[model samples]
Target: MAKGVISAADQAEQLKQDGNTYFKKNRLGAAIDAYTEAITLCPNIPVYWTNRALCHLKRNDWTRVEEDCLKAVQLDNKSVKGHYMLGLALLQKEKYAEGIKELQRALDLGRGAHPNSYMVEEIWQELATAKYQEWERDSTKRSWELRRLKESCETALEEKYSRDDVSQKTDDTDEISNSTSEQLAALKLVFDKAAEADTPTDVPDYLCCKITLDIFRDPVITPSGLTYERAVILDHLEKVGKFDPITRETLFASQLIPNLAIKEAVEAFLEKHGWAYKMD
Candidate 1:
């Protein structure tokens, strides 16, 4: 047995470790190269595609992120990262309805089988954004449809009564014809609530980070008793120095603690909008 017989899997694992080292050092290009080599050597490994996708995500390359994530999920449907990154990429492409599905699937799979609570919180935030976008889209569509219907009804009524025989329209028909917009408005109100088939955009200000003006992916409470997004606060501390932006109280990165209540509230919101949890 000579010493020159390393299996392809072993070689791939070595490349994967190298990629992780590069990733930690923030050398995303090198990390992607290493992951690409590993994927070439072991195309069946879902992690390899996910690793490359994450590197792409770091660079904000949504198209490549989408491609690699799709590949990972194709290999292993249970890959949480695969679904999550795909969701992010899709969201970037403004495919909110589809992105919401992938994100919810990532959370569901991550909770029971993978169980990364931190990642789950981020997924919920992403899911909320996706659902909000989806709601906006549906809202716009419903408005357009309602207007179209109202115009159509008005046109039909005018044509029917404009005839020399205005008497053909009874009192009941005249009343109905004049109430087109009103009837449509009532119908729209009912369907608007129902159309929240996904998440509602009326999220409370308390649930959002003042800095980002968005819901927190990782809410952390500062010593000043104010909560902010974790990554956002960390960046602020690094670049702007440690201080509560709102309270102007001196702060330290180490003083931040996980705000579990907010995380749970976000999760509950997503649960209520379960219809947004599947790709259309």
Candidate 2:
């Protein structure tokens, strides 16, 4: 409370503001410098570290981005930006699983804290893109595995039938026929197990959008706290006028917020129960 002396927090805030100005002008180096200075002054502030991480992200410096965001998250475990940046960094390094996990965490946190904020949508989109990429990779791997299995099965059957025993050839043919049936049954079991793992149970009604009656991909909340698919609601607003479909209360597109919590919950449910690429 000194008359002329400025507190460290105040000085750091000024530096952060300066950083924002530099960032807007595309002066990434200068923005990073300002943010670094702010961090030096107030090392405990997670935003300063996240701001610096943003500059590193622009420069494609994944290592530095990971380092800064890790520090940010260490300081504030609930930090959405920290988790988001860390996810991007890991993705750049080709750490798909870890990166996707961090993105999901960011989506969860951002949704819980600011359900209607742009950050929540951004996180959801990024998570969706990452999951798609993962699905592509898994699809390719599965195809290759299936081909290999088919080749192996053919080779085994061929070897069994090529036995050199003329004395018992007829008996051998009968036995081999039964063996082939058993092998086919085993192959069918393998595919059946895979299908069983991927098959989802009946979806809950609350999780489905009112318009589409399907599980939500991009759920948004009206002012009345009712959730619907973003695309369906926008279409409804344009065609049916501004009103809640169920309640018939006044509603506006501007008043809708991305229902991130529901999105997160749906994603978690799908991860455990649904087939790959089903959500997409």
Candidate 3:
């Protein structure tokens, strides 16, 4: 009986070798069949499962790859190839967190003999990129939601005041007014604190344009080169904190402000007001 067992093991080993040859020759289906036969012959061999997993991966049979890889790992806990293949299979299925953990484990195991070493590294990079972008998108969405909520609260408070004055109001109105006032005051305090927080040195040009546009209209010049509206000078003052004639010319030349269309519209409006304005 022992002799028969040894002979069976030898046959399984020979089958596995033939499967590997078929795999190397790019005969994936033949290789898979051979590997399956070997596994049936000697179900205890981790190598048979691992090789079969590779064949499944080549065939894009992700579910089979995972099954075989899990079996390989269960049979041999230290099988780095099994862990790595499992990671790949999970990543292909978009199970990012689990795949990341498994890939990290495979890397820790430090076994580079697996065929998917480069693929594993590439997947790690992709995972990191995707995670960062997702985080950024979520953060932006949260910020917008918070801003909307704040605006809604402020509008509701204003509408309540518009409906009735607190001094002559009923008890329910008084209580609501008090609560709204408290909430608004708290929100204002938080907004103030956020404004006082440390921020980036480089303020966006669009923000500057928006703030400046609120304070001043674009300048208008007569056809005889006499200026009517001092809008350009005011814009320069808002942007640079102090107006400098040289800087104004430089800003126009560089087109640093992105809303040139708005500026042109302002010029047209000025022209309609009997002043011919040259934006440049």
Candidate 4:
């Protein structure tokens, strides 16, 4: 009986090795079957769980991938592959915040020794993309709010001027005219300052570009390149400036604006160029 048991254990070990070979060949279904058989023969082995997790990942069975990864981690909390697999599985589910935390934990646990730099970089890139997307959404909301505020201010000014004109017909002529002129002067000053503030300052264009690129290159927040995010921000700023009366002309024609001042430059360019934009 003991001899038979020992022979069965040896067979299970052979089956596990065969599963690994199949996995290496990208024969995921066959690898899964072999790993499953090995687990039945020796359910205590952590290798079986780990190998099965790899097959599940290749098949894009994220739930099973997560299950097997947790099992492996339970068996050996120190397993770097276990934590990495969990993070990848969570990321695929679009649970970005949780996925980032898990990936960061994997890195903190000294998983850098693993020969998977490309995979690690991909994970980091995903996290960065999520963060940048969040930021873009927030910026959009603020732009809309600023547009509404400008419209409200304009409406209030119009209402106040209309009231003053009606009152001027019934009040002292000289006093009412002087008051109207003083108010108009103050309003003109405010409008002039707003227009002047729309253009970019003296910062170098290249420096602005470099700073924007660096923001997108951050491993934790912006893993991907800056092209996509930068384009989106520029496009949005252009739209906002065009629709915003106070900022429209001032943003379009400024020669001193830096190319890297993407937001401010777009506003200035739109204002200077009479808010004309090609949709293509």
Best candidate according to lDDT? 2
Query: Model 3: runs farther than 4 Å from truth?
Result: 1-6, 111-280
> For candidate 3, lDDT tens digit of each residue in 98-151?
775776676556424442255444444444443333344444565676678778
TM-score of 3: 0.48
Candidate 1 lDDT tens digits, 1-280: 4599998999999999999999999999999999999998999999999999999999999999999999999999989999999999998988887888899899888877744367876787677667766766776677677667766865665565455236655656656555655765766676556555543345568877889877556688987778898878878888997788889888988898999999888667655654244322
List clashing residue pairs in candidate 2.
none
Provide the clashing-pair count of each candidate structure. 0, 0, 0, 13
Q: Per-model C-alpha lDDT, please?
A: 0.80, 0.84, 0.63, 0.59
lDDT of 2 by residue, 203-265 (tens): 678889988887787799998889999878988999989999999999999998989899888
Candidate 3: give the clashing pairs: none
The reply for model 2, stretches above 4 Å from the true place, is: 1-3, 164-227, 230-241, 245-269, 272-275, 278-280
Estimate the overall C-alpha local distance difference test score of candidate 4.
Answer: 0.59
TM-score of 2: 0.72
- Residue 61 Cα positional deviation in candidate 2, in Å, after optimal superposition: 1.1
| Candidate 3: count of backbone clashes, pairs at least 3 residues apart or interchain | 0
User: Which scores greater on lDDT, model 2 or model 3?
Assistant: 2
TM-score of each: 0.58, 0.72, 0.48, 0.49
Against the true structure, candidate 1 has what lDDT?
Answer: 0.80
